[model samples]
Target: MPRAQQIRSRSISASPFLKWAGGKNQLLKDILPRLPEKISVYYEPFIGGGALFFALASQRRFKKAVIGDRNPVLVDAYQTVRDDVEALIEQLGPHAAHATDAEYFYWMRALDPSSMSRVERTARLLFLNKTCFNGLFRVNRRGQFNVPFGRYKNPTVLNPDLLRACSEVLQGVDIVEGDFEALAERAGPNDTIYFDPPYVPLSATSSFTAYDRHPFGRSEHARLARAYRACLARGATALLSNSDCEETRKLYRGLWVETVAATRAINVVASKRGQVNEVLVVGRRQSAPALRQVGASGHAVTSSSSLRRSRAAG
Candidate 1:
């Protein structure tokens, strides 16, 4: 049997093990149906918690998958899960035992990842992710994991079955690190790329793009918008999700845009946590006319009517 068919035959089930900020799990219902009917190769450049990727993997939605993130630690975790899950599970046992110990959690977080083996580093990240504040993966300017320990009554630090399932689904998949634009450039006519980059901050103080040491500021957002248009020009369908702010709406003006409501779960102030509107932009393979209407420079030629605003439950 062909590799794709062999992969699908396994019929494995998996889900994201890490708790990522701005993860798409809540919005999967809104995002999945917008995917291309047929995907020859699936590309997800900003593979945060990989909620959508795992969902698609469960359904065997694509023949091949190329997923990446700029965060090397995140990529390493995925690689270790895919290439050495048994060892990873073994390494995680001790961390699981010490999940509730604040000293142990802080000690593990303070250790430099460069000094540890791949399995050790992956284990540390997994442990920190499960035990950290709000399950966040924030890093300092020096690239140190800085989130404080989360004293949950019971946190599942290790789940062998879930790891095994994720590993099985990731078989023959590519887990890459570095610039998202590089991965976007690899998309072709047969591929569908999903961009879930750190959202444009709703407000200056509300920015939480610090998944790593590098900041994703306005320039990076502009570059990503260009990359999205390039993917559409290459005849590859592209879907993106971001905050429903004026900047984002202006950036993807001519594309099919829809607003969906998602609950904010990670606010510092309890009173601030509530439903917020996010936009989903879809650019299909046959959207050349729309592209032309917007111009080759990707400037908005049309009005805001192209944006279809409606509130769907996240």
Candidate 2:
């Protein structure tokens, strides 16, 4: 399908997909253009809500691609949808029709995954996603989905067409449960890697989504920086999205960076949820335009060709 022709607002590329915090549904427009045309495959290490992969794939095809994530259930959801979307859709039905009450949310959240039918399991995943506070998939240390039920009166949980569409797009992808670094180890020439790790808070007061119970602290950030370095050294195209922070800027130092002022939907407080600045760091050179749009809230847009040029020089 033509790249532009396949892009749609409804019915995403994968079905039975989990609604994740920091999923890039909103960033697809900004990040889509930055992607290089000539590439063998696509790799998304932190494939939370695979907004990018599903969006891009809906319009194009890849020779090979790998979607990896730390959440085993999330990864498994993708795999099941890819293999059999219809069955998965069938599995997700109960969750969509579930009561939006708090009690139902807790009950579904605490269900035994082992004894449930595939349909029930799918429904539970969808239920947690829709009813979770602001579509956040936060699990406790015991691996329990613990977010509270949302405030929506009606939610679309088992979207058949969307799931089928997603299954079509996710066909043949190597969906695995692993660290992003392990996935990045093999990214080389003719490959493009897009990193969307759990967003570390730019400020102490701003941290909200704790994707994993284990803190993704400085060490994890350092590990990501090393992965970027590896991707650049191996001549693969790489792009990273993170909250705009001086510390993160320091982490991705000496790389071609572009700042896009975009609306951030995930926030506990309503007033601060309007707009936020995010940095899109790339490990290779590409011509990018300036000033996407003036967000409702104050945000900055900047470009760092130095990092891109450095990758080329190497």
Best by TM-score: 1
lDDT at residue 1 of model 1 (Cα atoms): 29
Candidate 2 — worst ten consecutive residues by lDDT sum?
305-314
Off by more than 4 A, model 2: 1-16, 117-119, 284-314
For candidate 1, the 10 contiguous residues with the lowest summed lDDT are 285-294
lDDT tens per residue, model 1, 189-276: 9799999999999898999888888889999999999999899889887888999898897777666677788988787677877899
What lDDT is reached at residue 227 by model 2?
A: 92
Question: Model 1 segments beyond 4 Å from truth?
Answer: 1-12, 284-314
lDDT of 1: 0.83
Residue pairs clashing in model 2 are 13-166, 14-166, 15-163, 91-119, 131-150, 255-307, 256-307, 256-308
RMSD to the hidden true structure, all candidates: 7.8, 6.3
**Backbone clash tally (model 2):** 8
